[model samples]
Target: MKTLKRLIILTTLLSLLSISLPASTLKASPPHKNVILLIMDGTNSDILTLSRWYRGTDLQLDEILVGGVRTYSDQSAITDSAAAGSAMATGVKTKADYISMNPDGHPVLTVLEGAKLSGYKTGIVSTSPVQHATPAAFTSHTLSRDEFGDIGEQQVYQGLDVVLGGGAAWLKPQVKDHTKDDDGMLKTKQFSREDGENLVTEIGASGYDLILNRDELLRKGKSSKLWGVFAAEDISYELDRKALKPAEPSLSEMTHAAIARLSQGEKGFFLMVEGSKVDWAAHKNDPVGMISEVLSFDDAVGEVLDFARKDGNTMVVAVTDHGNSGLTLGNQGTNENYKSLPAEKFIEPLKKAKLTVKGATSQLKKDRSNLKEVVSSYGLGNLSSGEYRTMKDAKSMDDLESEMVKLMSKRANLGFTTNGHTGEDVFLYAYGPGRPSGLIENTDIPLVISEYMGFSLKTGKFADWYVNGEKFYRDMGFLVEIEGRTSNNPVMVAKKEDEVLRFPENKNFYWRNDEKVGLKSVNLYDGDTFYVHVEE
Candidate 1:
């Protein structure tokens, strides 16, 4: 009788507590130990917003904003990945297409290097090849982003504790993309270094446990020094990873593996993870592909956060370099009447797609007869009447492929201003120590990390005095040599507009007086010439 009475009393107390408490309550956020910097290449603030609307849920970034970053290159309002990545790596912005170097071609120290300086291990993971701009920015310095061979070589000697991604061809080489031998079957691509040295052999010799596939990566997770190469160029986008032959590791898997390997360091480590294909997908305005990349990146971010939360000393940062395709949310389509973008119309078709437009194009190029079948297999469907005519008249396969991508863009409700980077600011997110509270430049990122780690780093300027490029400046109605004019001696201009168009002073624009060029005070024409006379 006494035991029965006690049990009834305990059950009554539990029921009362459940009824009194609300279903949801806030929890404390995580602390820092190591710093994991995640760069979502070529994504936009608007794209993030659109993603939330489509999914009908908060993207989780809603709760993790550290601040925002203005992403401009040293000499232009728009920045490519190379310059943007360079600015984040070393707090200095270089000329467009340059990686980890000043205009003088000197190497700049990166946050990863700083980590190494303090005996902290370092790792870099990307969807792109390891030698791609973002990863190269942390490990190698080169005058041109196109110098893949040089970039690959320099990365080999960086003493990196963990490096994983695609681009085996850059480190090695290949005879031909689709060369054939005496056999009926296609020849297997071989690794060919110009000097006849194998990078794979050399990397293995340096004490790294080389992993070439997903199974290898997972089975060999405890390696102190690990290297993984999964694709000839970039690994497959997360949306298409299901069909990837030889099975590549997903971004989250790589992140977890990298952390496992690097966490063994006596001092904390620094790691950079790039959702690089996000830019590639955005460049083509493939909403479906871009979102897959974004989701994959988010998965990686979650993995990093989990590690950071457990360690209590890791600083996890998430940011994008800049906007691409000028992505905006709305009913942007071929329809005459504008309606709010129906998320289902875009989602259902893409979900049915077997290949990205890029993949379909490559397939069509290999066999012209397969064009119809390939089109049917993907979301692109049949070509437009004009597109079919243009494809017939096209002189080269490259031109035909370009037209296909455009058609694919139209099929989706997404509209693209340009297939390139834009001069827009991107959002920054953090969940650890020293997270900033307001707007910041791309260069300030490293400075913040350096401060938290008690290290000194060089900081990049706002790059307000740039003239875009020589050709661009000329197109902007300037008739002078690049070196002939300086910011102090600004480029002056006269046009039908009332106000004088100048440079540097309005810095955000190539030509501005007191306001934007199209505004009433500053109208500009194609042939108008600008000059600046700084009279004392």
Candidate 2:
């Protein structure tokens, strides 16, 4: 009780102090009409150097080089994408696997959400599942990143103007004999709901143009809202996307389409574009795949920069959430001749490969007898005797791919220290109006973006919009109780007289007695407490 009193006193004093400050002391929102935040997931700073060398030309990202951003979470030094992305989205550091939630497990408004509330069109585009960690942080709030169905559903009701990516499977109910692994075992999948809710149908019914393929996206009719889900899981990597079934679009294509649609609004827009597979390739320690993904992301950056330059009122900021795969130019093999080695030694070897390690691995049979023949067709041949034996004896497909990546990386004289995320500062780039420069914390992202969006997270608006559910309801003469405290789908029930309201966690709707009520926002709970949004 004493601690709570002190906190209340501190808040009151701060509010009084703010009220006493001069008008100039409070920085006004910038005059920018739009803001675009592009995240190249799991990209290391060194990857830029390698990609530039591979392309033999300067990337569009080179023109906007600003400084760097420190990437760390509230709990761990080496942060995962969910926590890292949430820090950038909400301007607060959080625990791993948390999407737009604070360390105390309460919902915090994201920059995109705030932009929407401020009357700006908002959108999110990514190469991975839109419900994947990085994109999910900007679009939804959840305690666990693994809550794909919940995240997918929340995005549909968040009132965004545009959303394009993969993970179509999560929106539909599971089908028998959907897909199988090499062992003929049914792979685990997460579909819409345990009770079978079809969110894709709901999206169309909610007035969004539901697109399924590249042709549909290109020839899309004029619509106020657009939602495209390209694949069952993540869309294919850039190197392997050419042969992908259903003909998915490139990352740049998605970015271009999103920008075109989002900019039509008179009030401006906020869009987040993510090259999500760069991290996936780095986790495999495949330099060729990583380079391919980076180049694709750079192309998307080109599209963003082009739009920002032409508009002149848009603020463009691009940065990676975190670093991965400690990739270095010279490996142990080049220690003695590192300085003497030409750029061709690194660039030429990677150029020979036409497919990513994933694409090559997909061509191999169960027996693995055609490892050499299959890899040779992909321009990754000449494996040493020991390399052949190791790959042949690999226990699983994952093990085989790892070995293949190591051998290919060795041949290119490239080095990778680990297959996991690294704790490092990532390069930050920006262009046009209201671009932040110098070294900044990842949490500073939303604060910077909010400055251009005509809102302030530091003001009383945040506390008023998202309130402590139990206290707020109790103050209104209602009794509150929580159900499913241990399950992913938790609900907070409030009762007063004959009025009863049920708020489900991580969803955009609630129940009043027997009637279903849809909300423009989600109700958040961090295990112990519930945070509800108050409509203005």
Q: Which candidate is the best by lDDT?
A: 2
Question: Over 4 Å off in model 2, which ranges?
Answer: 1-32, 175-192, 384-386, 483-490, 509-518, 526-528
After aligning candidate 1 to the native by TM-score, how far in Å is the CA of 104 from where it should be? 3.3
- Local error of candidate 1 at residue 529 (angstroms): 39
* Candidate 1 local distance difference test against the native: 0.71
Tens digits of lDDT, candidate 2, 79-190: 9999999999989999999998889777888899889988899999999989999999998888999988778878877878999999887787773324435532446554
Clashing pairs in 2: none
lDDT of 2: 0.86
Candidate 2's displacement at residue 195, Å, is 4.4
Q: Candidate 1 lDDT, tens digit per residue, 313-359? A: 88777899888988654335545644655666545555556766555
Candidate topping TM-score: 2
Ten contiguous residues minimizing lDDT sum, candidate 1? 518-527
C-alpha RMSD between model 1 and the true structure: 17.0
Which stretches of candidate 1 lie above 4 Å from their native place? 1-32, 53-56, 173-191, 330-336, 339-341, 362-367, 381-405, 459-536
